[model samples]
Target chain A: MSAAMTQASSQAMSHAATDKRCDVSVKDVEISFGRHVVLEKLSLDIAQSEFIVLLGPSGCGKSTLLNAISGLLDVNAGQIWIGGRNVTWEEPKDRGIAMVFQSYALYPRMSVRENMSFGLRVAGMPANEIQKRVADAATMLKITELLDRKPSQLSGGQRQRVAIGRALVRDAGVYLFDEPLSNLDAQLRAELRVEIKRLHQRLRATMIYVTHDQIEALTLADRIAVMKDRVIQQLDTPQKIYREPVNRFVASFVGSPAMNFMPGRVERGATGATFSLGDLSIPIQGYPFKSPGLTGAAVLGIRPEHVLSGAEAGPNAFNAQVEMAEPMGADTLVWCRTPSGASFSVRVDSGPSIAPGDTLPVSFPVGTLSLFEEGPDGRRL
Target chain B: MLAIRPRLASRLAAWVALSPALAVLVVVYIGCTTWTIWISMTASRMLPSSNFVGLRQYEALFANERWTVSVSNLVIFGTMFMIASLALGFLLAVAIDQRVRAENLLRSIFLYPFSMSFVVTGLVWQWVLNPTFGIERIGKNLGFADFKFDWIVRQDMVIYCLVFAAVWHAAGLVMAIMLAGLRGIDEDIWKAARVDGLPTWRVYVSIVVPMMGASFATASVLMATSVVRLYDLSVAMTNGGPGIASEVPAKFVMDHLFERQNIGLATAAATSMLITVAAVVGPFLYWQSRRRAAAGAH
Candidate 1:
């Protein structure tokens, strides 16, 4: 690892702990299996009644971090606290957290009632209470009829509801979901995602959900933690992570179709500063950011929506050849490329008539672009 | 043009593909049973005759001393062997599933017995259980000359020796079936049970074993069939010695058919064995269908 990368990882770990609002906080946690390091100095604070979503790509250590919090994995370094008590060495059940697995791990031979109440039954809960809890959770998931049915008899959606209900019956302070909706169809996933959100609101329970889908993160999270390369790249509210990402990785990762970028030079002029790409230069007219440090080597990052494609639009303008357009009835996403081979996209009222090889000069609006240092470090300035 | 249901073609093809197997099944299994039933009613010595004398063979079969002893031996041997094999196999499977090191090695050792012919297996177990030969000799070499494992010598105790050898022969196959079942189990059940604060033994008893229903069914069916058709192991191990002890249904039928020139009684015995199997298995199949239907409706 580079010295700069090492510094970033250490800095990320240094904020390992915060005042306990929820039951669990992980401080500078690092986990490795054999010679391969899976998570390094990962720090996260989960508050009570807060639904925190850990969003990242595969192998980015989001699940590993959750495992560390749940005591399923041992961290080579760092400490964990749960319920205002240090529980770094505690077992999973002792940590007061229940997990809804990605695959609904229902016992096939057991009826839905037994499936939900298996844990309680094993714990020697009274038969009456076990029955009551199973009934309550069955009613909550609208699975009263399904209580007598085995998991095999239920549909995918019902099984997922039952899985969630299994965790709910535990009444654990924190509920961890490990990409629980990844197995469902898109339509069912959307429906259950809303249902889970409503469930969180009504119950007012703390939930730590993990997924690679940023849409899910954006829709469900009170706070989103974007991870990359075994470290938390950025952790903030969904809006902040999208609007003001700390680095290039976070900026590109949290948006659909991702943010478009153009390698350019940062030029300082009389009125303000601007990013020069090809023959066109976009002036950073507002947003008081000093660009003298960026100099010539910097990347200009702008969201696709920020570029105006409609006839009636803002001051910054450039003519362009439209390459292609994808229409979705309400909005059309137009792909345009500059003569100098710089490409950008804009979503407008309707698509264009241009073909794939068409040339277009697209403008980069003022203050909508973010500048990043070029070469080895390449962090946002 | 005639219109067929969408699934008709595949259904037709399925029947077409199964015709040969279906023909053989009917001609061999059903035909043989009917023929065997016919021979039981005829007063035949070694060859079939047209003259029929009803129930004479069955009456004589029940009166025969050796036949009565054979029936008693089969019941004792089958019950003990099946129970012992199932228990030992399930335990071995559970032990191997504890993420033990050298799992494949352990599995191969358990499964190697299944690959051997019953001839070899019976011989090995007979030698091991021999009083003056194997166990006693080994014990004497270790300076304990009075180690008696002579169940093969006692008339009342010979069935137990047969059970020991049969269980040894069958348990390995049971272990393999159960291990496959255990491997197919979702990894999350272990985690969920652990999170539920269940101890290891409780998890196995309350969760793991109960969920392995399909595997248990497979093993039970295989073992039940073996119990009915048990022969080679008993012959090699005890030779029905110690006064007609350790005799099984298959051995009894064979002895009557070839050795004693009693085709009439042999066919009678075969018919009775078939009826016994149908009596036990008929209700079992019906119950399974009903349970499956009930499970499906919910």
Candidate 2:
């Protein structure tokens, strides 16, 4: 009995780690509104000072997951750990997480200083300490001169900075952001995105940001968690996700203009298994399809940039009819239809003035092909 | 060959439409107010008289201890009632705004009080607060025979009873105003404050209340006006009974004007109240409007 008690006490002591542990950990989290589930069995482990972005399509539970971390929405099943403390049922403040909102919810009647000091004041901190934190956060945000102005008196960018400053004054272990730049104009969004990146580097605070915009996720995150249909499709470095996506959703989600999924068939070739669409045969091998011989139907995931247009072709070159040419200043997007009636896009630096109905031979580099198995929901392919 | 610009014609038509309403407002409301002030200056009992009293009525008003007591009672009642009603109203509004079930039932329960006339309100409160016949008696029968709740009769504590019923009647309207304010709050604020690591109550206190300035102002003005014009609740509840304990300023002016047939003293009291209100309210309103104009500019 004494040995068992010793082991139990040691186990309990091991669970306790100071501020430098994993910043956020969600285990088997499920959130449902009545009967409709938004997030199901989602688990993620976030290391300290890592900037993680939740990127997904609308209704994909990215925002819901963020809320779960913030303790705004309770998970039906699962425990949330923040800085080595279980905070699944804790209040948002107790969880040591601060959030910046999409709409910049600044207090219209309060000056920037008061808005920043409100949380600390409510915690019954000394007035002088609250003022010091407010001043430091204001200076860090470059909003010291605007401290006396109310939110209504500030511009959208200024108000957003103050909102961020309000969160910074708390000096929590984690920061949660819910599409904080969605309210700004396009120009301001771009500018503030840079500012946020700089702020993250300076603070080295753990952050979990949610956004539907893939570019923001790609640019801002040290690690990106791509979500779809209440599940995390893939979580990896942004470049890895761009290069190697585990499934169709991750493949399509991580890139702009989306990756194209062309219907193809696997046929037995002399060397190995080869992909066939119409008369074109592209050789592919190994781990993606070894035993579960993809015969009936499969999808070939190819990005617009990978569809090379040149004199010499790669593995899967076929005749494609150009449907539309969209010139986007730096690069040209050539929308084409394949011989097998699949539509896709090709990116070129400066294409030979391709127009509608223009016939061109496009090649898909087989090494870059991401394959999905055929399933009933269509995600398997 | 038009006399003014095209936009000016629209302004002219607007002014033309407003002139009748403006005329009535100026003649009926402002004119009667000015006439009342003029009559109070004279030694008029039944009608306006030319005889100058030269501060005689003012001297008499100062000497009347009942009038003095009435003024003090009004101040006490007004402050307590306004603050209490506002707090209770805001709390009710916040609670209801949570979108709890049985919303319409709770709303009707709160709003039904505003549908009552002051006569009915005072009578109902009197019935409930009467020590021998009301809640105290009920409690006594329920086995607490030592119950002593005779605030309506006590001279020192009578104003509290007045505050209780007055707050009960006016808080509903304040709730409605605050509810509208609470509803107009952008849902994004709740989500943002949640993200900012604030508890629900902090969000309401720091974010929600501050953003609800216009609603609070509207509710406050409505309540304050009601405070100055408080009359019937006093008359029905206590009837200035138990030896003039619950008398308010409006009641004193009203009793002297109608029941006592002492128009000189009544008009004199009215004039004093007018001067007092102007002394306090005139500067306050000027400063408020000026600040509002400054805020609105640019």
Best by DockQ: 1
Span of 10 residues, lowest total lDDT, candidate 2 chain A: A9-18
Candidate 2 lDDT over B1-298, as tens digits, reads 5766887989999999999999999999899788767666678776568787777777887799889888988899888988999999999999999899998899888988999998899999999999989988998999987988888888888789889998989888899999999998877677666555567887887678878889888988888888888889988998876688788788888998888876777888887888887897899899999998998995
Model 1, span A140-214: residue lDDT tens: 678888888888878888998988888877666688898999999999999999999987877666889999999
Q: For candidate 1 chain A, which ten residues in a row score worst on lDDT?
A: A11-20
Fraction of true inter-chain Cα contacts (below 8 Å) kept per model? 0.62, 0.62
The superposed Cα distance between candidate 2 and the true structure at residue A211, in angstroms, equals 1.5
TM-score of 2: 0.81
Tell me the tens digit of each residue's lDDT in model 1 across B7-77: 78879999999999999999999989899999999998888775799999999988988878888888887
User: lDDT tens digits, residues A1-381, model 2?
Assistant: 334323433322212122335478999999999999998888999998899999988889999999899888888999999988999898887777788888887777778888898767766666766677677778878999998887878989999999999888766668889889888898888988998998888777888999988899999999999988888888999988888887776777779878888777877767887877766676766636544665657877888988877565544567789999899888899899877677889887764687899887888776676777664234432
TM-scores for candidates 1 onward, in order = 0.89, 0.81
Candidate 1 segments exceeding 4 Å error? A1-21, A127-132, A135-139, A286-292, A350-362, A374-378, B1-27, B289-298
**lDDT for every model?**
0.80, 0.82
